[model samples]
Target: MVLNYLFRRKPEYRTRKLLCFSKEQMYEVVADIENYSSFLPFCTQSNIVDQNQSELKVKLEIGFPPIKEKYTSLVTMNKPNLILAKSCDGELFEYLETVWKFTSVPQGDPMTCIVDFSIKFKFKSNLYTHVASVFFGKLVKCLETAFINEAVRRYGRSSTCIFEMTSQD
Candidate 1:
């Protein structure tokens, strides 16, 4: 079993709600590619290769301790609702994908949003995997918090919010 652990790859995923923030507000925070470095941990650089009305092609350089990786991705969005990203030409990851879905709070209640964020990735090298495992939890929390922080920075503090990891894979 220990030997299998060395070769096995695992996917990480989490879903949480960001209450008191509108769907549009939460969606905007996730879709903004250029401002990632300023708020996202380990995001050293971000570049937009191309963009259109519906999609964006971007490259991001992320460094986590001993590992630094650069990857390009194609991002598409369905306005205030969903954001999808797929890894493009990249050397570090075998596969990397992220999905974000924002749902509005029920009518007659405070304007709130439920942000569901998930990521699935596999590094080409096992060494990267081991290193990532050490920082995985921190990495995930940082990513989620970055968006929430940005929302507060842009919008305002939310007195009502429920944040939790729905699951992991």
Candidate 2:
């Protein structure tokens, strides 16, 4: 299905750079991240309709204030390397694509989960997309913090999972 009618046309998006963990380790993290809404606090509902060792179909309910938002997506787990997912068939965004990559360089005991991700999201031609992109930074921070906290919560401080952003400068 198409996420939005905008996709009736073609779409375009771009990714920036990345930091943390070796490529292998990053890939592991990406694979695990497919079920991220499962752990993210802001997410109210995450229904994994189907799954395998490396893929998922999730129905997600995310909190954003005015109203709760729901989106169902088919995510492919490009393990130990990349996890790319797009808007299911009929959804909000006209077009959407997110790519996540992991890279790691031995960092002593704990392995850094350096993640490089790009999101190309377009709306039905309006300011909504612009507004969302503007606030996306904060949302990403929330995700990062929650992700790190969850790592500690699950793996404990002794575990080797470092979720830190690398400097682009």
Candidate 3:
């Protein structure tokens, strides 16, 4: 009982499926840091303070109910393959990291790709952590759906296959 509660407050790992989109297309959607607020959940604003071929400095404002926070992060991208973002400074979080990995489907199986998305974060405030723990699973699902919906909106859906699993799976 105690362990369950403790574990819920720590970093979480999740894997989901994405189908029909090429690796490059999926990469473009995730790497477009400045447009995140338009699709991402609770993201009120996003700005690219600096950007280059390999890295981007971005700030995002997210809010849920009465809580609102802004944080800056440096996102490093490796073309149409991998993207990683880490929080540089944030009052509400101790650490926040998210990774997106895209792998093309085997040839002859249609032009599809598998997107592996994972996020780990810890809040600095115990009160906030407690509040978040109750909704973490749902929050992750919303984020995943947001990305997929955005992809369909932009690239048009060809095939769709989405499944969710935790580290336990």
- Candidate topping TM-score: 1
lDDT of 2 by residue, 1-169 (tens): 4334423433333333333334664455445644666777667776778888777887777775776767777788766767787778556667667777655544543444456666666655455665555566676656655655555555455544444344442
In the range 4-108, model 1's lDDT, one tens digit per residue, is: 585475657667665678888888889888999999988989999999999999999999678678999999989989999999886888888898988886673
- Predicted candidate 3 versus true structure: per-residue lDDT over 37-156, tens digit per residue: 889999988999998879999989998778788988989999989999999887768899998988886763545777888898998877667767778889988987888888889987
**How well does candidate 1 match the true structure in TM-score terms?**
0.89
User: TM-scores of the models, in the given order?
Assistant: 0.89, 0.64, 0.87
Task: Please give the RMSD to the true structure for each candidate, in Å.
Answer: 2.4, 6.5, 2.8
Candidate ordering by TM-score (highest first): 1, 3, 2
Model 2: lDDT equals 0.59
lDDT of 1: 0.81
After superposition, the stretches of candidate 3 with alpha carbons farther than 4 Å from their true spots are: 1-8, 108-110, 163-169
Lowest-sum lDDT 10-residue window in model 3:
160-169
Question: Which pairs clash in model 3?
Answer: none
